[model samples]
Every structure is written in structure tokens, then in C-alpha cells.
Target chain A: MKELRWGLLAAGTIAAEFAAGVDESKHGVLEAVAARSGDRAAEFASRFEVPKCYGSYEDLLADPDVDAVYISTPHPLHGAWAIRAAEAGKHILCEKPLTVSVSEAEKVIEAARANDVFLMEAFMYRLHPQIRRLAELISSGAIGEVRAVDVAFSYNFATPRLTDPALGGGGIFDVGCYCTSLARLVSQAATGQDVVEPEEVLGMARLDENGVDEVAFGLLRLPGGVLAQLACGFQLTQDDHIRVYGSQGQLYVPKPAWIHEMRKPKTSQIILTPEGGEPEVIEVEATQGLFAREADHVAAHLADRQAPELTWAETLANLRTLERWRAAVAR
Target chain B: MKELRWGLLAAGTIAAEFAAGVDESKHGVLEAVAARSGDRAAEFASRFEVPKCYGSYEDLLADPDVDAVYISTPHPLHGAWAIRAAEAGKHILCEKPLTVSVSEAEKVIEAARANDVFLMEAFMYRLHPQIRRLAELISSGAIGEVRAVDVAFSYNFATPRLTDPALGGGGIFDVGCYCTSLARLVSQAATGQDVVEPEEVLGMARLDENGVDEVAFGLLRLPGGVLAQLACGFQLTQDDHIRVYGSQGQLYVPKPAWIHEMRKPKTSQIILTPEGGEPEVIEVEATQGLFAREADHVAAHLADRQAPELTWAETLANLRTLERWRAAVAR
Candidate 1:
């Protein structure tokens, strides 16, 4: 298969990480990078050893050598840039959350479908091998019909852009998206559905002076009587834990964020406790960085026209849930 | 202090445990045992080595030597027995749920107040030293203004009596009450209030053919934007874990049930994770069984008129929260 050429849409922190991941991937190459300033784009190109640098996203997208674009811009800018990339006939891997609201997500998805381009939300942690194994265990009925899921993703983050409502900043959009997505993923894995929608959603938030939620809690009732509890905040320190309880037993994953998988190979531990038995720890090694695996996954879709791990319908469902949660909390 | 004489009401499993704990206490003595049948009372007395046995609950309450009674009857019968014991001028330690509903709890409390007798719910887990230490840490702002609590108390309980709907057998009355009570306890500790009431509650459940909930989930919005997630079931195997997340850090107790503390001395572990720091495990050793601690606590209240660890107002608040949860799920 021909190697898929990549273009970095922003020279931000995440963009640098993606460039390194692209360099490490076996089926992808970094063709060009773009930033608002030419000097910043040239510096990123020099650091990642890319062949070309463009001062603007449009210039990079128009380059014939770039086959796909990775959008790492701020949350509010994702939809506009992604639609532009789709119009330029480039496949897109946009960072999470895909957009700030459900309507924006809908527009991005429609643009991708109309332009006949592949698009996936960059939820890199879902591409980790440990997550796949966990999903397999749930699908195999290791925990016998999941009844409830408890997820928490929190950190004491402080930044102007992160706390600014104008920048689409808040715990829900920043980190809570992971908790919601994982809940949906596990629900689908348990019930064998391509996508599962929450029947009911209740949410509470502690908002800052800037009208951004510093802390948020959400409860969702999924189909088949499955319940999920999610917590995300910028003011508390959570260990990034995820627990799924079922009729027969339960499984817990500490450090579900897979932080080490971003920069280097690492191992993750999953604790499985069966009814009337002791807890067993299962360790899974990811030999490749999560970003590289994600890149390869996108490459497979580009090469064979295979469906990406995250489907468009599922993305829309998740965004809608987020919108409902925000609405509930606002009331 | 003089030894407080005790009477065992209803020769059930919990009655036997309470009898043993009374025997182990330095300030309590088991004076009599009571059951509907004289033979059953005598059998329980022989097993626990009590001196006297009575055929009916009234006869045991009439005994002059029985200064306090431990009520261990089924859920639907607790209020009646406790009120009767209070009228007989005996201090009462009733098994948890306290009663099946909030109104019943109110009547029991009123009866005890009218008779000028001490009444305390036998939530033995609360008497464990680890729980006390955890409360102290929260009060000391170890976690800094508690924001959310995640609690689960589940087991595969399968007794005919436990599954009988007419007997008020269900996860909410049986196990979910613990989650609600703990949430309140931590909330009070955080806010330095004698009791805390949830502003809003939402619940969902999976009920069996008997119309008894086998699994239940609840979300509560407490004062000051604090939120709590609780899960309880008779169908799942949860290790009874409790996690409290706060502004500065979080704490997790692995074995929150502390059921084993009823008979044997044990050590419980609490993990405290400060913001941007490693988690530290704090171990607390219970020199005496939790039931013994409970017995001593009652003895202190009887001898010096000391207040019990769980107050009547707090118990009522917890029951009201449980009632709201049940009502929400029923809808």
C-alpha cells in the first residue's frame, strides 16, 4: 500500500505530538505543516523534519503532496477548518471534541459526506490496544450484561484559553467528552449496537466567573436499563478511573487516560473481579504510541476504504448527548 | 460505667451478630432473647449463651433487666418493634433502613423522643475507625471542599425473604440506603453541618418479576453544587467502594461496607490522592468489631447521655433522600 501523506493544520502542542506520531508510523508520512505565521510553520517543519511548510491552512490543503489533514486548532475553530479541508478533497482527523456543539458537528459531518472524504474525531485513547482488549472482554460477556458504568476524568488545569467560554472551554468540552464517549463505547460493546443513545440525561455543573464549567457531573440512562455516571472537572484531581459493573462481575481500569501511550510504548492494568472470587490484574502492552496506532487506523481506511473505528453516526449521537447534558445543567 | 443490659429482638442472622457483639463489649450484657416462637428464642439463647429467652417480643421488652434492645427484625417490622421498645423505656439500636420509608422513620424517632429513650440506627460500618478517620480528614480539608462522591454497595443477595416485595425487600431499602447515607455523611463533614439534604434526585432501576428492584442507580444534587452518584444492586458483585472527590484531592475506601468488622477485628485501607501527587494508603485497625463499637456507642449514650454517631435528624434526611430516589425511579 502507498504511504498516506499527512499535513498538520496547526503548529500547536498537539500538532507537534501528531507529527512525531506520523514520523513513527509505518504507513504514514508528514508532508507539510501550517501555522498562521510562516516562521512558526517553518520552525515546526524544521523540528519534525518535514519537506514543506505553509503560512496558512488553505495553502497547506492546496498542496498536491498532502493527501490528508490533521486538525489540531482550538475547539471553536474545528468545524470551519474541517469543512475547508473536506472541500479541498482531503481526508480529516480532527481533534476532540469534533466541534463545540451538536449543530457544528452536523455541519462538519455533512461536509465530509458531501465531499466524499473520510473524517474521524481524534479520540486517540480509544485507539489504544488496552481499550480494544477491554471492549473485547465486555463483548465476550466477561462481566455478564453491564448494569452500570462509573467514569471520572479530572485534573487541576489552569489556562486562559482553557477557562474562556469564547474558546469553547469547559470541563465538559475539554475532558468530559472522553467520559461520555467511553460510556457510549462500552454500552455499544455490551449490547452489540453500532451506536447507543441515552434515554435520559441529568447533569450538574460548577461554573466559573467566565461561565465555563469548572466541574461537571452527568448521569445517563442508556437502552436496556444500563446506567452510566460520569464526572469531569478542572478543579479536582481524579486518577482517571473507569469501572463497569455487570450482573456477574465488574472490571476497573485505573489510569484510563493512557497518558504514557501519547509519547512512548506503555502497559495498562485492568482489574477484573468475578462474583465470589478475587480480583485479577491483567496487564496489556502497547508496543506503539497511541497516536501512531490512530494514524495507522486512518491509513487503513484510506487504503482499503475501510470504515474508521469511530463512525459518523456515533459521533453525532455523542455530540447530541453532550448538548443535552449542557442543556440540563443550564436549566 | 455500669454494663448496659441488652435484649435481642427477633432471632435472625443480624440478631445473632448483635448478640455476639454485645458479648464482646465491655459495657454491655445480653440479658434476654426474643422470637415469635419460644423454642426459637431458646435456641438462639443457647447458641449465644444468654441467660433468658422470651416467647414474644412484648415479654422480652417487659423484662426489668433488659435496659436496651437490639431490633433485628425484617424491614417492614423495624418501626413497630423499635417504637414498642421505646415505650418500654429501653434504648434501641435498630438495624438499618431504620424503617422501610421516611414516614416510618419519623414515627420511630417521635416515639423514642416521646418516651425519652435513646434511639440509633445500627449502620455498623459507620462505627468502624476507618470511616471516622476518613470523616476527620475530610473535615480537615484534606480533599478541600468535597464536590462529588461515587459510592457502590452491591451483592448477589438471594434469600427468599430478601427478594420478597411485600417484606420491603429491594436494593434501595436493603443496600442503596448505605450509599445514600454515606453521601450525606461526607457532605456533612465537608460543610460542617449536622445534616445535609439533597436538592434534587434522579434514579433508575431494573426490577424483577416481584416488582423489587434488583439493580438501582441514583444521582443527587446536594447543596453548593455538589453532586453524588450511587449504585446499588442485589444482582451485581460490587466490592462496596466509596470515592470522594474534592477541589484539592480525592480519597477512596476499598471496602466501604465493613461487614466483616461485625465479628472480627480487621484493618481497612483508605487511599488519599492529593492534587499532583501520588496516592497514599492509610490503614486503620479496628481493635474491636464494629458491632462491639456500636454496642459501646449505645452504652455511652445510655450512661452519659452522649449523642450517637448517627443522629436522628441525619437519619431522617437520608431516608427522605431514599424516598425521593425511589419515587423518581418508579416514574
Candidate 2:
């Protein structure tokens, strides 16, 4: 198989994890690491055992050897870096909340389209086998006429970069994007459509002193009368489960995000309960880590211009919903 | 203990359940039953082994042997019958919602006050030991500064009474009441207040052909910025779990509604996961069925004019919120 050489755009925690994932991928190789400071970039390269390090993002993007770039910068910097990478003729796997707002995401997509490069949002959990099976079951009517979805994703981990307003930091942009994306994915699967947008959006948030939301809740009314209730927070510890309710049965994933799926081998269970019947547990065995699968998916898209796991239109729809939710909570 | 002679106000499915609960209660007796038809009333009386059966509601209200009334009629009839029962100098346990609207609930409360009688809405799940323990834990800060609640209570069972407009049918008035009541209960527990109402209410619903909502979703913003997302439907089957997210930890009740707690012995579990810690499952043994507990609670209040499990103000607040939700969805 042809290898896709990857350049790490930021020496952050997630970027480090992505590098580890790339190391495990059969069709991807972490070729370079980049940071604002030379020492940080060199340290990251040494840690990851990459061959090259760049003192600045522009230098990494300018490297002809870098076949694809993973934009793992802070939430606010994703748009500018993704556009620059696309302009430099490199495929892009941007970390989630692809940009902080819809307009920024649109610009990134436009840039990618204009430059003829592969651009996909790095929503690694969607590449997991369990989530794929979930979508398949919903589409196949395992639950029968999906009507509602409830998701709770929250954890009590706080840092200056996560809570600072200047950094575009908030639960909505950090972890809430996952909830929004999952809602859209399930709605699309149930409707068998390419895209779904919420007809109505309502949200509330608990903002910290820095004017960034620590926790947030959102409700969406999708087409075909599906109601999605989502809760995301950086201030609480929750079970992080996703439940899909349908006319005949229900499906539950104990760990919908599967955050631990990237670190080690983990077994996940999908519980299906038909109306007035016993619950059936379907256990899924982990083969490749979630991020590794994501890396391979990105490599395939880069090789043949195949469709990304998350399309550009779907990402824009999710960002639009997120913008509306932020506005609702602010009001 | 002095037994309170209970009169069954309707010969419906719920009414039968209440009759069996009264029979099991230590301080309540199933004395009489009434139905629109004489034969149905007689049949219910025979099955429950009651001594008296009345063809008309007026006859049962006028009977001197009836010490209290359990109003188990359809949703729309609850207010009128509750007011009549209050006027007849009988203590009342009215099935939820206490009334179809806030105005009707107020009238029923007014009548109860004027007649010096006990009045309570039968939110049976709240009377269960597991729910009571949940409330205690929240009030004691077991989870620490509760911030959000997500509840799903749905089942795939449709009947004329559930889907017909004339019967005051809908998912919201039937099962939705349970979700709304649980949200309020948990909020009140977190805030340590006797009453708490959502500052903002937003909802969406899928109305069936009769203009009755088969499925409904509501979002509430309670005091202290707590967000509650509730979904109820007659068109689907769900896990029917209640999750409370807090700043320090999380608490989850596997069966929040405890719908099956009335029929047989069941042990429910509450899973608590503190920040960065493993979840601890607390198993609670059901000493008395939920309905039996409700029957005993009503009997105790009737004997001493003590407060009922669900107070009139709390019921009014819940109804008012439900009214807002209906209006929001209609808009």
C-alpha cells in the first residue's frame, strides 16, 4: 500500500495522540512535527521519533514531503492553518469543531475545494467499528423508525486553554461538537439522507467567570420529527452514553465516544431492547484503535479522493447547529 | 393504624392497579368502586372484593362509607373529578397530571383548601425508596452541585385513550408527566427548595393524526442554571433512565420511573461516578411497591392532614411548565 506522509500541525496533547495513532496505521506515517517554537517542535519530533521538525506552521505546510497535515492547533487557530495547508497542496485532517464557527469551516472547505485537496474533520470516533455498526442498525430498522436521541458527554477536566475566552474555549467548541455530530449522524442514518439540519434549536449553558461555557445543553428538532437532546460539559463526570429510541425498540451504546478506544484494546457493547422484550447485548471486538482507523480512512481518501467519513456538508450543518446553540445560550 | 376507606373513581386499567395497591397498603382499604356503567362498576367491585359499587360518580361521592377518593379517570377528567371530590369533603389522590392545565389544577387546589381536605397528585415513582434515596443523595451533595439532568421515558404502546384527541391523549400528558416531575424533583433536591420551576422552556413534538403528540421533547432551564432535557413518547421504547450530572460526580438511576415497581419485587441500581474514579453501584431493595407506597402516603396524610408526597404547589409548577412546553411546541 502507498503511504501518506503526515505532518503534525501543533505540538499539543491531541497532536501527540494522533502521532501515536499514525505510528500504528498501516497506510500512514508521521513524517514531521511543527510548533511555534523550535525547541517544542524538536522535542515533539524526538518524543514521536519523527524524522523532521519545523519551527513554524508555515514551514511545515511548505514542506513538499508532507503529503497530509493534521491541524491540531487550539480551537481558534484551526481555520487559518487548514486554509494555509490546503493552499500548500496538502490533504487536511482537521481536529473537531473543524473551525470555531460555520463561516470559518466554510472557508476551509472552499480552500480545500479550490486547491484540490482532501479535507476531512478528524472526528475519530465516527471511524470506530461500533459507531459504524450503530448507523447500520439504525438504517436497517433494527430499532424501527427512530424518534429520539439522548446523549451525555461530560468530564471534569479544566485547563487555561479550555476555559479561556480568547482561545475560543468552551464546552460547546471542545466536546459539544461530538454531541452535535453524533446527533446529525444518527438523524441521517434514520432518514437515509446525506444531510440533516435541525428545524429548531434550544440551548442553555453555565458560563465560567471568563465568559466561556463550562457546561451546556442543547435540543434539536430534526426533519422527520426526530428530537435530539445533547449535554456536554467540562465541569462534570458522566457515564457518556448514547441512546436511540425508536418505534419498535431502542439501542444503547455504553461508551459512544469511545475515548479510550484509541489508547488500548477495549470491548464495547450495544444493547438492543425491543418493545416489551428482553435486552440483547451485542459485544464488539476492537481490532484497530479509533484514531488508527481514522488515519487509514484519511489515507484512503488522499489516495483516490474517496469520500471522507464526515462530509463537508455534514460538518457545515453541525457547525451551523453549534452556532445557533451558542446564540441561544447567550440570549 | 386507622384504615382509610378508599373509593375507586374509575373502572380503568390504572384504576385497577390502584385498587390492588390499596389492598396491599397497611393503612388503606378498598371500600367501593364507581364507573359510568353499573355492570362495569359491579365487576370491578367484585374483582377487588369491595362491598359497594355505584353506577354514577355522584353516588360514590355521596356515599358516607367512602373516606377518600382515588381519581383514575382519563387525563382531561382529573381536574373536574378532583374538584368534585374535594367539594364532597373527601381526601383525594389524583392521577397525574393533577389537571390538564394550570388553571384547572389551581381550581382543584382551591376546592381542597376550602373543604379542608388532603390533596395530592399521584406521582407514584417519587414514593419509591430508590427515588427517595436519589433525592436524599442530591440534597446531601452526594454528586456535588448538580448542573444537568437527562431523562427518557418512552414505550411503544398506543391505544385510543393514548392517541385520541377527545380523551386528552398524548405522550406529554401520560408518560411525559413522569419525566417532567422527575426533573423538578431532582432540581428541588439540588437547590434544597420546596419548589423550583424552569426559567425557560422549549419543546418539540410529533403530533399524530388526531393532533395529539405521539412523541415529545422538552428542555428546561432551572434555577442556578441547571439544564434539564426530557423526552417522552408513545411511539418508541427507551431505556427510561434518569441521569444527573454534577460538578464533582454523576449519579444515574437505571429505572427512574420504576414503572415495574408495582407489579413485582425488583432491585434497582444507582450508579455514582465521581471525578476520575470508577463507578459505584448502589443496589436498593424494594420493601413496598411504588403504588402501595403512594396509597400509604395518601392514607397517612388523610389521617393527620399532613403534607402529601407531592404537594399542590409542586404539582402546579410542573403543570405550568408543561403548559409552557405545549405552547412552545405548538409555536
Candidate 3:
């Protein structure tokens, strides 16, 4: 059996979940945990039964037993930690949004390239079999040529970090990136390319008093004539469904009303309704749940510099889209 | 029972549907049929058992037995025929999209006002119990404060009348009016007003070779801060849903993957998902069907010279939104 020793960076809630997921992952082990606060690091280490714990991120990065670091800090700090992890010669899996802007994401990508470390944005949903099966279903021409795509990942709760612009926050960075990522994936599946860029990005948002968008909506026209509608916010609870309209049929994920988002549950359902045909429900199961599967995915691709599900290039593209949407909204 | 005799002004498929609806209406009777060809008029009259058959619309308008006429002509001809019908002192039930443009709609409304005749645009869905109950639910704060509304009505088939601009066709005039109408209805319900206007109408479309939108999408910001997303066209088959997102809950119409559109069937469902609660399905049945209920609504409002469900003012407002969307798409 092969194992990739994992060190948890930033002892946050997400890092604790990742430690648990590594326990379930086939090719991963929770070797160490680290946080700026020594108490938090010790608490996480005790809870996860890790062999090592560190008060500083540098200690975790410098650990010889750790082959990879899962970066789950606030997006504002993701780039710095990921760069340090890369320079430390450890495989890096950073949280989504990568950074606040495209330039920062580019810098992080360059650092990863210069360090020659395995890197993948922690868009965990993309690595799940449910979404992989989605790409396969779309590419198989089951729904025909995709024309329109709609994705929403909005909720009603607002966290201090989510609404703080200085912390690389707001709806777009918080939940909207998931939407653009899904839209690009649909484009990738529809065009049979590695990825497709948006030709047009039109956005409208309701900004709070601090100039941070509380709710944001965007329409992206991809190169293949696909129009994707994205809605994300901290003020509204939407159905949060992924709807793909194709030339010959349509595909919808999850079920009637609930959304998958962070919860793929035991089985994921994709309803394919063909033109003049009945809806076919395709279900894909994640044996170890979404987070575990994501951890395993990183371990499986440790030998490679990037993940097939979400690559560094795609991460840069997704950041470009989020920036364009924000600029459009601000305009 | 009081009877408002109906003379269908066009021997078209929609006219036949209206004639059938009139048979089931409470205060309506099918009395006459009119078409350019006398044979077509006679055939429609005989098939529907209409006593009066006229070759010209003017002749049927002149028939004293016809108390009100259902103008089922293409939208390009709706204004002229509705004006003539009012001039001949006949109450009128015109089809959806009362006129090609807002100016045309206003002119027809002016004519109807000058003649002091009963006139209503036949948006049958508005007359159904399903939509009326939706208004009550929203007004009752069942879904809390409305923030976003999404409505789509799209189909794949492109008829000659739909593609020809001169005939008052294209997706905007053909089906997009319904989207705008639903948007206004939600706005009205949310604001507790008879109707509300859009503050901004931003639209994008995929124009065909003939400069007609094969598929159109719109984002409308209402006066009360509700953003509505509308999609309509002849190039795709959308779920054709009416989704309302509120501060505390969300409402989705029809069921799973199907849209009500013209088919109210026996019962219509509105799924209200309260925040942190299970979805509640509210079913409202229209015993007389959608079109028949529309006919009965007009029959019940003939003496008032207006309909409470959809007034000429709201019709004008809806048309203005559609025109603005089209102009935005063009720009």
C-alpha cells in the first residue's frame, strides 16, 4: 500500500474535516497539524490523533515526514501558505479562489511551477465522482450540445470573513467561484477542451454599505456560444441547483429542491431529460463521501504537478472570471 | 346565467382552443367564427357549433349577437382588430402580447377607452387559481421578502410567424412577454401593489441570421429591489419554471422538471421551502382549465370594461419591459 503523508495547515474547521477525510482516504495519512495558535494546533492534533503538531505554519512546511500540505486558511492567506508549501518541496492543495485577484493567483501558480510541486485548488466538488460522472455524461452526448448553463450556490448566513473585502471575501470569492468553476467545467465538457474562456461577463450585484456585494449575479458567454448564469450571495437561500440546457435535451443535478454544494450525500443524482424522451436518472455514489474522495484524489495525483479535475491553469481562469464579474458589478 | 357571446376573430389553432374554452366557461358562449377565407370560417363554426360564420373580422364585429370577440390574430394584427372590435362596440379578449410594441399597445388601450368597451389581453395563466394563489402566498409573506424572481418559457420549434419580424413575431413578442408578465406579477405580489415597474432591464440574446433572437435572457431590477431573470426563445426547451426567491424562503412552480406553461392540467403545484424547513407543496386546481378560466374571468368582468387579474396598464408595463429587453439585446 502507498501513502502520502498529509500535514494540515491552519487548524481551522475545514482542516479538521480534511484530517478526518484523510483517515478515510486510501492513499493518505494525517501526519501533522499546524496553526498560528499553539492551543488550536494541539487541540486539533489531539482530536485527529496526529503524530505531530506545530504552532507555526513554517514548522509544518519544514516537517520531513509530511509529503503534502492541505491549505485551508482564509482565501487571503491561501496564496502565501501555498507558495511556502511549494518552496518547502511539499505537494500543495490550496483552498478555492486561490487568491483575491488573478495577479495573485498567477504569482501563486508561478511559485508552484518554479518549485515543481504537485498543486491543485481545493475545489473538492470537482474531484468527487459525482462531478466526474457529470463531465463524462455531458461529454458522452447524452444531453446533446450544451447551449445554456445555470449554477447557483447561495446561502443566507454571513460570516465576518465572508463579508470582509480585506480578507479576500464577499459572495463572489466565497461561493460564486463554485459557480464559475462549474460553468467552466460545463464548457469544458461541451467543447471537449481542457477549458473554455468567457467571451463576455455581464454582472449585477447588490452591494452592502462597505462596497462588498451581498448578492451577486453574472452571465458569462463562453466561446462555444454557451451562456451561463451564476448567482451567489450571503443574503439569499436559492435552490442552488446546476441546470444545463442542451440542444437536444437538458441535465439537472441533485433532485427536486435540495442542492449538493458541500454535501454529495451517499449518492448523487443527475436527471437527463432528452428531447421527446423520458427523464433518465443517473446516480453516482461516493463510497467515502465528498471530502474523503477529494483527499484521495490529491494522493492519487501526488506524482503529477496538477490535478486532472481542476488544474492550476483552470484555477487562474476561474479567478479571471471572478475578477471580471466583480469589476462588472462595481461598474 | 349571464352569457357574453364570443366570436373568434381568427380561425387559427389558438382560436380553436379558445372556442373550446368558451364552451366550458361559466359566462361565455361560442357564437361566431371569422377568418379571411369563408370556407375556413364555416368549417371552424361548424366544428365548434358556432351559429354565425363570417368571412371578414369586421362582419363578425358587426354581428349584434357577438357581445365580445376573442382576437386570436397574430400580434401584428391585434391592435387594428382590437380597435375595430372596440369601434363596433364589442367587448374584446385579445391574445397575449396585446400589441407589437408599447406604443401600439397604448393606442389600442386608448381606442378601447374611447369606445368604453370591455378589453383584456388573454394571458390565460393569470386567470388560473395557481397564479392567483401564488400572489396571495407571496402577499401573506409565506416566502418572506422577495429578492429574486426567475421565469422561463422557451420551446424548440420556430414557426414562420415566430421568425418573421414584420408579423409582430420573434421570441420577445412570441414568448418573452410571458416572462416579463410573470416578473411583474411577482413584483406586484411582493410590493402589495397592483403592479410594479422595472428599474433596469439588461438583456442578452443569441440572434439568428434574420436578426431575430433565437434565444434571449434578461435580468430585470424592479423598483422594490427584486431582480428577475427571464429566458425565452424558440431555440431551446427550458424547464419553463417560475421560481421566486425570498429573504426567508423560496418558491418553485410546477414540479420536478416540467413546466406548467399553457398546461395547468387539473392541478398546479407551488413548492414553498421555508428557511431550515421542509418543502410545502401547495396545489391549486382550476376546474375549468386555464383557458376556460380566462374566458370566465373576462365574462365575469365584461360590465366593468376591464379585468382585475391583468389590466391594460399592466399590459402596457409588461410590453415596455419586453421592448426594453429587446433594445438592450440589440445594443
Question: How much is the lDDT of residue A106 in candidate 1?
Answer: 90
What value does the lDDT take at residue A258 in candidate 1?
Answer: 46
**Residue-level lDDT tens digits of model 1 in A186-294:** 8888988888899888887777887788888888888756788888878767668888888778899987844645878788888999866789999989888888888
Residue-by-residue lDDT tens digits, candidate 2, B1-331: 6888999899999898888888778899988899999999999999989999999999999999898999989988999999899899999998998888898889999999899998888888887888888999899998888898888787788898998877878888888888888888889898888889998888888887667888888888888567888888788676688988887788988876458577554788899887667899988888776777788888767754535457788889889988888777774
Flag the better candidate by DockQ, 2 or 3: 2
Cα lDDT tens digits, model 3, A216-235, are 88888886678888888988
Docking quality class, candidate 2: medium
TM-score of chain B of 1: 0.96
lDDT of each: 0.85, 0.85, 0.83
Compare the candidates by DockQ and give the number of the best one.
2
What ranking emerges by DockQ with the best candidate at the front?
A: 2, 3, 1
DockQ of each: 0.55, 0.64, 0.55
* Model 2 per-residue lDDT tens digits across residues A161-250: 888888888888888888888888899899888888999898878888777888888888887678888888788676788988887788
Interface RMSD of 3: 1.1
Q: Put down candidate 3 lDDT per residue, B1-331, tens digits, no spaces.
A: 5888888999998898788778877788998999999999999999989998999988998898988899988888999999999999999889878987889889899999999999998888777777888888988998888888888888988889888877866787778888888888898888888878898888888777778888888888886678888888888887778889888898888532123534335766889999889999887775765677788888788888899888888888888888898998774
Candidate 1 residue A150 Cα shift, in angstroms, is 2.3
On the 0 to 100 scale, the lDDT of residue B287 in model 3 is 72
